[model samples]
Target: MKKIFFTLLFFGCCFLISAQTEPKVGDELIIEAQDGPTYHHIKFPKLNILVKRGKVANYKSVHGNVVIIDDVITDKDNNTYVVLKKKDGSKFFGYLTKVKANYEKSIASGEMVVKS
Candidate 1:
């Protein structure tokens, strides 16, 4: 009984950990570019480009890269803006477009498919 309990517990933990999704604000993430102008460009140490939600911007990491759903805050006129702050303390803003995820190859040989 004890052996069976322990085995089930271990597998349960593994399943939960694997199911947890990544990609959060302030997390060092690596996303592969599926399709875009900046395809194959490894954007390292990528941070959240858009501060607010519902915007579009480029998001990259050493292990992964992609142009993800950006939630950038916009003005009253609904013009979106992005703040790209580099590690060197330099900052800039630019317009971005929302792109569909084409391909996502994980750093660990797994795949993620996100559909709206």
Candidate 2:
């Protein structure tokens, strides 16, 4: 009886630790830039400077790896936005308008891999 109880307790502790370590969609992650100067410039048309890999930028277009915190949000004018948080503690407001499409694309491309 004592051995059985101890075994179950050990397993329970392991389970809890594993669960806490799992990555979720909203979790911040480090994403390496996969594009060149032209790609960054064209993608982030508003930004004038070339974005370097591993450097966090304000615009989502500068990154292929990003985290969409939640679902699509609509404003009074029907403008949509997606919440994106970077690994460097920087948050993008109104990051992307086409939330559903972008989210699907990210998942399909394996850019956003939430570890189980």
Candidate 3:
């Protein structure tokens, strides 16, 4: 009886830990581009040229990547942003568009999600 109780307790703790650690919206993630070493590029509002996300900006680690939530836009454009911050404090933004075939591949592969 004691052994069974301890086993249950151990499993319960493990479950709680895993659940708590699961990624959520606004959580940053490190991802690699499928095409090559280059990061994903996006044309953001008020930006003239396309900005890239990932190693190009020197945010190679997970700590540098920032998950973006589109809570501000209530429309159904199905677009989300991912922000990357460089060591020099520069920030670049990219969008996850379902309309784009390349982005669709990344979304399907679980490389990027709305809320993980």
Candidate 4:
């Protein structure tokens, strides 16, 4: 009994350690240009907000852009929201979409690619 319990515990620990903890702060990611101009998987900042900030909210414009994980916000529900910025420390055209997304989900759907 002891042997069986210890073996199960060891495997559980391994599984937990190998689990994916993606979108960690400071991670470099690339915006993947899916077949369409709009990114349906993840939300982008509102067009009006972008334009109000003297920017253009062109979905195609962000294609292939390299961004860094600037902030990671996790709500009480365990939903994750990531704030991304350009590699140069400048914000994205839309900026702060405040959308809840997991990097694994986006990456799996080809919305974002892990650069580093």
Clashes of each: 10, 0, 0, 0
In candidate 4, stretches whose alpha carbon ends up further than 4 angstroms from where it belongs are 1-18, 46-57, 94-101
What does candidate 4 score on TM? Answer: 0.62
**Model 1 alpha-carbon miss at residue 15, Å:** 2.5
The best candidate by TM-score is: 4
Error of 4 at 22 (Å): 3.2
TM-score of each: 0.29, 0.31, 0.32, 0.62
**lDDT digits (tens) for residues 54-93 of candidate 3:** 3234323323243443222212665433332222333444
Model 3 scores a C-alpha lDDT of 0.40
- lDDT of model 3 at residue 28? 37
Question: What is candidate 1's lDDT per residue for 1-116, written digit by digit as tens?
Answer: 99999999999999998665433322223343445434332222223545453334444331232234333334586433322222222222333223222222232333222322
- Model 3 misplaced stretches (Cα beyond 4 Å): 28-65, 69-116
* Order of candidate numbers by lDDT, starting with the best: 4, 2, 3, 1
lDDT per residue for candidate 4 within 9-32, as digits (tens), equals 999998886565545888888888
| Candidate 2 lDDT (Cα, 0 to 1) | 0.44
How far residue 59's Cα lies from its native spot in candidate 1, in Å, is 13
- Order of quality (TM-score): 4, 3, 2, 1
lDDT of 1 at 95: 36
- The per-prediction CA RMSD against the true structure, in angstroms, equals 12.4, 10.6, 9.3, 4.5
